[model samples]
Target: MSRIARCSCGRLTVRCLGEPSRISLCHCHACQRRTGSAFGIAIFFARARVAVDGVYSTFTREAESGFLVSSHFCGACGSTVWWEPARMPDWIGIAYGAFAGTELPPPDQQVHVKQRLDWIRLDIPEK
Candidate 1:
């Protein structure tokens, strides 16, 4: 069965057609600014297997690598749904918060640790 995740507003639902390749905790400054948190959780999936429903809006930012990263969110509630990297056109990273009733495993990796807030301590090693 496909995994379905919806925005808090319930207006947007994303169907993930297969298991995620991995889950990550991103400490990138852009992610911190977007989420207004210490880190952002992302579930990686093959772009071909993911489908989104309902109207949504996206804000794009250029990554440090110079690739564009498009972040999708529910227009009504401003809840983030997913993101896609322009360079990795075949992959989609769904926001972990979208999985309302599901429990997320601990992040398998942490990226951009250098950008992490000094007050937040990440003792776990990245897988």
Candidate 2:
């Protein structure tokens, strides 16, 4: 079954043509900065299976792992919807926040915990 995610303004929509390969939380400072939150949730899917509609812009940055990652968002509302790693061009990472009705899956893992904010806590049983 396909899943649909859209920007807050509903101007940009992405159709997930297949199930996600992985779902996790990123605690890296760059992710925190990009999300303006303690961490970011990512759902990984094959690039070829994801279809995007409407206009969006991508901002590129180098990850701590030394791979370039591009964050894509709706140009009109500035709502980040997905990302893609330069090293893994065939895969895309959809932000959990983009899903409007679906329940988010539990994060499988947390990356870059070292860069987590001092006040943030990810002490949930599943984390």
Candidate 3:
């Protein structure tokens, strides 16, 4: 299946050509800060199966795992659309919220469980 994830202004977009390789709910503090929410859902796809378009800017940071992550956002609307992690050289992570108008699979797993908010509970396995 093909899915298009776009920025709020509809300028930047990532086109995913098939089912995502994995989807996870991330509860790390960085994720919380980035999303301005309790957590962030990351939808991952193989680099070969994804295509990005539109003018964008990137912010690169070191992840908790010690690898650098480059997050791409729409230049016009400042919405984060996707990211590339040094730890996962061949996969790109898209913000699940960017695919706003479509139905997506529930998160396959949860990460940084120890950092998860006490009020949040999910049936998915933790990693």
Candidate 4:
């Protein structure tokens, strides 16, 4: 079955068919800023495996990987649905928060641990 994720107002939704290639936690400063939180979880799937609906906006920014990342967000609630990172041009990144569940799988790996908040700690190793 496909996993469906939607914006808070239900104006925007994304459908991901099948399992994701990977899921990870990003502790980079940019992620913290984008999520307005300590870290962000990214569930990745091939670009072609996902479908999106409704009008959205894009914001392009350079990631620590030195690639332009274009994020697509809902125009109504400003919730980010997915992002296309230049590093992985063929993949779609679905924010974990977009999912409609609280007991989602834990991130398999963590990235940018050096930039993680000093008080934030996880037993997972940076990959």
Candidate 5:
């Protein structure tokens, strides 16, 4: 299946093709701040499997794993759509929320559970 992930203003669009390699929920502080939420749901696919149209602004930072992470967002609306972690150069992670009306599968793994807020309970079990 394929899905189109676009910014709020519909300026930047990502055509995510086929199935994702993995889906993950991250409770790390960096993810929390990046998403401005309790956790982040990321759909991972090979970079070549996704096509991006339109220019994007990016934010780069060193992750807790010591690898550089680059987040790409819409230059017009500042809505983050995807991110690339340097450690996995071939992979692209798209924000699950970016795909409206599409119900993706549950996360295969959940990381940084220690950083999760107490009020949030998913019980999706870490892999």
Candidate 6:
């Protein structure tokens, strides 16, 4: 299946050409801050299966795993639409919320449980 995920202002977009490689809820501190929520649902796809459009600004940082993670966001709306993790060179992660009017699959797993809030509960497996 194909899907399109765009920034809040619709300036930047990611065209996903097929099923995602994985979907997961991340409870890491960085993800929480980046999403401004309890967790961030990351939809990962093979880099070869996705195409990005429009000009974007990038923020690169070293992740907990010691790999650099580069986030691409629309400059106008400041919405982070997708990111590239150096640890997973062949994959790209799209913000689940960026895909409007689409019902994507539930997360297959969750990570950084140690940083997860105690009030939140989900039926998904832990990674």
As a whole number from 0 to 100, the lDDT of residue 123 in candidate 4 is 83
Off by over 4 Å in 5: none
Q: For model 4, what is the C-alpha lDDT against the true structure?
A: 0.90
Clashes of each: 0, 0, 0, 0, 0, 0
Root mean square deviation (Cα) for candidate 2: 2.2
Q: Taking the tens digit of each residue's C-alpha lDDT, what string does model 3 give over 1-127?
A: 8999999999998999989999999999999999999999999999999998899999999999999999999989999999999999999999999999899999999999999999997899998
Tens digit of lDDT per residue, candidate 1, span 40-99?
Answer: 889999988999999999999899889999989999998989999899899999988788
Candidate 6 residue lDDT tens string, 1-127: 8999999989898999989989999999999999999999999999999999999999999998899999999999999999999999999999999998998999999999999999998899999
Q: How close is candidate 2 to the true structure, as a TM-score?
A: 0.89
**By TM-score, how accurate is candidate 1?**
0.90
Clashing pairs in 6: none
> How close is every model to the real structure, measured as TM-score?
0.90, 0.89, 0.98, 0.95, 0.95, 0.98
Report the candidate with higher TM-score, 1 versus 5: 5
Error of 3 at 116 (Å): 0.6
lDDT of 2: 0.86
lDDT (tens digit, per residue) of candidate 5 on 22-116: 99999999999988999999999999999999999999999989999999999889999999999999999999999978878889889998898
Give Cα distance to truth, residue 43, candidate 5, Å: 0.4
Instruction: Report the C-alpha displacement of residue 106, candidate 2, in angstroms.
Output: 1.1
Lowest summed lDDT window (length 10), candidate 3:
118-127
By descending TM-score, how would the candidates be arranged? 3, 6, 5, 4, 1, 2
Q: What's model 6's overall lDDT? A: 0.95
* Candidates 3 and 6, the one with greater lDDT: 3
Global lDDT scores for all candidate models = 0.86, 0.86, 0.96, 0.90, 0.92, 0.95
lDDT at 48 for candidate 2?
A: 88
